[model samples]
Target: MRLTSLFFFFISIVVFPQKTIKTSFVKKTKLKAESIVSVTKSSNYTSLKYIDNQTLFLKLNDSIIYNYSNVQLGDITSFDAFSPLKIKLFYRDFNTVVVLDNRLAETDKVDFNVVKPYKNVSHVSTGFGNKLWVFNQDSQQLELYNYKTNQVSAKSLPIQSNLIDLKSSYSSCWLLTESYLYKYDSYGSLIYKIKNENYTTIALDYHDNILLKSANNLFYLTDYNQTIAPIEIPKLLIKQFLVTRGSLYIYDNEFLHEYQLIKD
Candidate 1:
């Protein structure tokens, strides 16, 4: 049944791709900061990033601030906070994933190295229903793992390309590879595949529009069949970027800029 769903989605994507999404950029606000680590849109209308120090500092919604520090797990690889109630911190070097509450208090930890049926996890994202989306490097597959049960509930077929990025919502997840973009449903069905076109990273907006970025600038496929269009903005350093809730955020190490997405 899973394979059938996968094949169906592959054919569906070839016939009916993503809808056309036109965008107009309107500068909203720009703020400057120092000693930043990284940034991500953790919610529909909010942006979050940490600052450098022994401890991890987070500024959320541009108002509330929180700090979480842990030195035993090894350096933080990445984080996912799409949920209002939880945050996931992946320490890739240690093959561990830590879960935190909204208050930044540690609530759970998973050490894959010590866990039964050891999984060489490469990436992870928060999924709905107490589950986590994990990329099992040993199998080169995406797994919808029930972290609470320490079991794999669902998984995608073995991926043939190098994984670039993994972005997920409660219902779906998108895997970015070196040459293709794959979207899988909650059941791990491969629903879509698109060209990478040199885009190194990706962000899924609230509208499910795919935002793309290359080494030089940000771009998006206005329509699946149409060529990608550049997201025009003032020339500045682009260290990191994200799209959420009809907004595009670009942050350098020092300056953070927000642009309203005026979709046409």
Candidate 2:
């Protein structure tokens, strides 16, 4: 009788395997724009920047056009639109960052080589109160730099993993290493460290939602760390993707696809 009961229990477990319920919903919208190099969405408008050889073209909200070309800065290493009024353009090769106004005009410039201690910065992102979150490669740590004061206001403990990427918002900074992802608050306090699971890239929306890309698949992580796959993505293989606000942008075959994500 005991053997029969154990056999039935084993069968029930196989028949009633747990199911993973998706917690997020998304609606995809396709927009046709040609020869687009990059797209960034802000609270008010979307900025599309394109490059053709030595010349650069920028279209704001599908209407305005801005052109710029500079051989000295080389290719743009990072384009941060965290603040529409104060966009950040980092040239890693030159160890410089250019601040752009809402009109995409150069307003300020910072060269890390001139800073004391002569720190070598590899990554930079917008931060609150006229500051920037920069990754000092020489120290293998994150630093909150006050551009106005030209000082390092805060710094995190030295990270001990191979750095993959770094991203930041007004109030928080996230560093992704080979083994883990670290989140730091505005004061440089370590908030959380999550073990990575083969995530190649990550993006944080304005709402603090985390979106991750692994291989060709994109996944969204809920506050509880539930992995949810967006069901409405295009069938084409995603070459690259980014999340901003409530939208997911996918690039495939020279086409930029935009999807609006709705939380359920």
C-alpha local distance difference test of each model: 0.76, 0.74
* lDDT (tens digit, per residue) of candidate 1 on 1-264: 999999998898778744444455545445554333334554365546553543556666767478887888767887777785677888999999888886788888988898788999999888996899999999999999887898887899999999999988898888999989888889999878887888787776664566788886877654345345667666778877776676777777665677776555
TM-score of 2: 0.79
Candidate 2: how many backbone clashes?
0
Q: Where is the poorest 10-residue window by lDDT in model 2?
A: 18-27
- Candidate 1, TM-score vs. the true structure? 0.80
lDDT of 2 by residue, 141-204 (tens): 8999998888888899999988888878888888889999888998899988888888877777
- The C-alpha stretches of model 1 lying farther than 4 A from their native spots are 1-47, 60-64, 221-228
- For model 2, the local distance difference test gives 0.74
Minimal lDDT window, size 10, model 1: 34-43
- Candidate 1 at residue 88, lDDT? 83
Best by TM-score: 1
